[model samples]
Target chain A: MARLPPSSGPASPAPAPVACSPHGRFGPYGGRYVPETLVEPLEELTAAWLAARSDLAFQAELSDLLANYAGRPTPLYFARRWTQQAGGARVYLKREDLLHTGAHKINNCLGQALLARRMGKQRLIAETGAGQHGVATATVAALLGLECVVYMGREDMARQALNVARMRLLGAEVRGVAAGSQTLKDAINEAMRDWVTDCQRSHYLLGSALGPHPYPAMVREFHACIGREARAQILQAEGRLPAEVIACVGGGSNAIGIFSGFLADAGVRLTGVEAGGRGPQLGEHAARFAGGSPGVLQGTFSYILQDAAGQIAATHSVSAGLDYAAIGPEHAALRDEGRAEYVACGDADALAACRFLATTEGIIPALESAHAVAEARRRAPRHGADAAIIVNISGRGDKDMEILSRELGLGGAADSPVD
Target chain B: MPSDSRAHSSSPAATPAAAGFAPFFARARAAGRPALIPYITAGDPTLEASRAIALALAEAGADIIELGIPFSDPVADGPVIQRASERALRQGVTLEHVLALAAEIRRRSPVGLLLFGYVNPFLRLGWGRFAQAAAAAGVQGVLATDLIPEEAAEYRQALAQRGLEPVFLAAPTSPDARLAAIAAASRGFLYAVSRTGVTGAREQVPPGARDLVARIRRHTTLPIALGFGLSTATQVEEVGRFADGAVVGTALVAAVHAAVQRDGPGAAAPAAAKFLRSLRG
Candidate 1:
């Protein structure tokens, strides 16, 4: 397993020299599967990433940005009310929601933007679903004064109108992809096409840990500070590692980020909650690990939802962020090695969890993060009261007001005066 | 899309070097002209119409006919070919359908056959099964667009065992070391991508293309087919200055597309033949 972050607490002591994903593989997964036109650029990226990983100057720059710009060391808070109510394990919340741009996505965006600048790239390109990544990319582009373009599906743009406005206001071009399924999968296709056409001048700042080599490893490293901080904080609070760490897996950036800290800790359980849209049938849900088999999509060899003819199957999810047909290649490797467990959180349960967290703790979790909350709610009461479970609240639900209002039928009702 | 194409697929293939591209290149060399290969998406507009287009391309002196197996997502293709693939896929074309088309076309003409696709569908059918099946259908070479030499050991072994060749693409960005590796892994002909972009028709062949071909020539004696932008006779003649063959993909695809749109599928074959002859003259 790749080592997490440098920590003051008892962590993996001094990781090996190599930091990238073994140059292009994670066991049987994560190969550089692309046209020869992209091979040279991927190689160049891999080399640059390798050089930057150990460069003290580069690390110092990223650390400074994370702290001063994106707001690093996102609090690992004890959820006293939720913990008392759960009546089982003490619950902790990794407050990535408090980060700038309102999500953990800023962690990755800042790092990749810096890398793009370092590489002398003239443009930054990305793909997004819930718009968190897009907003974060746009925010970083504004901060760095770089040209930015984000590919978002038409369906996603509809639900994420708030973020669409934010991106445009932040001076990034938002291209609405109208292709297959009109969601994250299609958005990714359009972004990759854009990158292929202008790879020399642009950097494909992939938002997840699911693309071709280096990216899966690179994005994870960028977000690894989440796990690193949580590990150190949890140790100070609970005096030991938590019994479980839960996060939602879309293309699996945040989950992989937080999981990186505890990957080597055999005592800590890693559970990835995927979006179970409505049912277990294909096209009804986006739970790849629950229903998918090994296949390649968007350049990674991972568990993917595909038809018998190898065409990618359509996926559904109430939370746009978790509505992808495949998981990250490393996540697949971790699943195969029994290092991490994956489960599905249906739309209803996740929605309920979102409201429950809001009412119980005054924290409105993003629908994507609510999947983890739903899983934690289920597993909390079952575990011992002394045991601790850290749930990664990946983002705030402020952007989800539109979808939430529509999904919960909270709209078209007469306004009530504040009591 | 069921057929009797696989009826003759059970018998394994003979040596691929003797069967398809080698003889075609030899013939073109004898004619003192660069080889012309025309590519079309099988089942575009309709599968039967694609058959006529392939036969027409063969009759128009195409050294090889490449049949693109439609996939749900084609990242390395430009808008024209992407739309063609979308049309083919809407008609429910799969690798098996393309193989069936190749088998039918094989029976009617001795022209070289190559199946172009991405890695997922090819691996979905399993390399062993796909190789046997493709070779059985008389396909000479297979070009999995995303399969690089580093990840193609199993694929090369599987295809070579079945007397089929693995065609690899060499890009302008490919360094000499990578070019040598790609050349060593390839069997029939090395695909020299003229530029660092998706397949499309361009106004003129970029000057970088000839340099790329020259670099690739340092690595292999195998015929290098210059691709990505030879849309006219001048362009094909321009390629003859450096490479042994010119691959026409998006340009011919556009011609067939317009023909089908203008006069229905019946006119696509004649239009394709006319387009190829125009490219040669």
Candidate 2:
């Protein structure tokens, strides 16, 4: 507790206004701005959540689920070689990749699934783009013996067919949405459609830290356990918290999860790395950081890359997961408050770091995570050798290897190339 | 039951819907026909055109106007509504503009306005602010196409506090108990989704929709409005026979789109009015 930084920023000429409000209002950003019909259920969730917060049983149960089912308390391993190359800044990796289902997604899914079960819901529904969240939801539905249906964009279903098959094999129904662009955006559209039509027995498990109201708050709470564990582990391992903590942002769940632990702390500098793609030019990147305005997309008010008329413009990124047009509401708030700094990493930078880590640290990160690793690698030289930096290794690179090999000219590397 | 007498309900202020409903609903109820609730995408082709379409719908015998605030992904909507949403979004219709249009309509039309939209926009605006603004804009009711009844507390509180009704959908897939739960909490009117899919004209309402409506009736005394696929007069009459109101959206929007394409903006609204009045007749 003493190690945590103070809530307000240290005295500065113009301290960035503390972004988040108690009721999830990040200066006019986050709010419970949903349809009137969903108000009661959101209230129930809030009530249940409030009760769950202090209930010893709920905490213990959540801990047990995290430890046994989700396989949490993920490691923070020292990246010796990567650090040596980084102008001597000691780098450590919080390995969320090694968690069950091979990404940090499962942590939130497990918690949400349990909450759904406790709520007496009989079924779970979700929308998936790259099919990562669909796979994660399917895994939980299988484990809990709950009915699950996932809506995936028809295009994404075709591109990420393997993930679709994996979800189906797990006994969850996968519906390929044939609407709009047939991508993640469309999948979310269809899922919301399903939720409106089938809200009685179903719970819509959102995949990211985006969405309106309870979702941003709820997903953050679930993922907060990640930060909680990491905080305790880091404190136990090192004399104090690291100087800077970094994570890749795609809907920003993993980054927020790690950052929430240090939100009140003024000393820790939180950095969220977005997929810069080809650069900041329109249609070239998905970095809402590099180019975004406060607008509504998905469900919440956040930084969205929209056209002049507030239309969702087409976004591009090497990673399907990070090719979104908006950032999470919390991240948008954090950016506004100056509590965090957002950086954009291009495809070249991420790929370079992916290769660098594979060669130097013997670890392969998801293309999304590689964005943070790339930034850390680039900035490590400036931080000095004694400075400690923490980068969240968000996922195992297995899902990305195929795409990376094809895109990056890695002809035949069963083992990804070293830097 | 007379039109003149209907203007003043015996105890309107005491009742929820009766309290807020005006002289328009009075005449509508006395006519012995269910209210025609026609939905149209605001700005399917253009904002001005959509505004004209709204007026045309009201003139065409629509008692309550369910103006659809188009979303990028309209989940509960079928192909036609999905297409309509796409067209509206392409034309740059936003939630802010949608509410502004409703405010504009309130300035001229006495027709009861109920906004039909996805939850994302309201969520984006923050429920409290959206509800207050919507109520101030003369929106009597809101039908969120995506919000579940169980998660409706904040939205419901905000809407109720603003004197706006938060309407919920009762579908064929819902169980008797779940229908009861939704009906008990719903206000203004229960949006009885005729089928499982999103909003669009269907060949027919599912055989179970009538039973679902009946089940909802048993739970609450609120009026029931049937929607999702009742485009033609035949379906409207069919739904009117049992429900208090019938909502026609996709078909009306389609007509407006067709009229706009054929005769341009000048004739679109009148054409829509003519087409919509045909549904009630």
The true-versus-predicted C-alpha distance at residue A173 of model 1, in Å, is: 1.0
TM-score, structure 1 vs. true: 0.95
The clash count of every prediction, one per candidate, is: 0, 28
Return the number of clashes found in candidate 1.
Answer: 0
Docking class of 2: incorrect
Which portions of model 2 miss their true places by more than 4 Å? Answer: A1-27, A54-61, A412-419, B1-21, B43-60, B63-69, B91-197, B201-229, B232-245, B254-278
Error of 2 at A71 (Å): 3.2
TM-score of chain A of each: 0.95, 0.90
Cα lDDT tens digits for candidate 1, B86-170: 8998888888888899988887777788899888888888999999989888889999998899889999999999889899999
lDDT of 2 at A77: 86
**How much of the real interface does each model capture, measured as fnat?**
0.64, 0.26
Off by over 4 Å in 1: A1-21, A415-419, B1-18
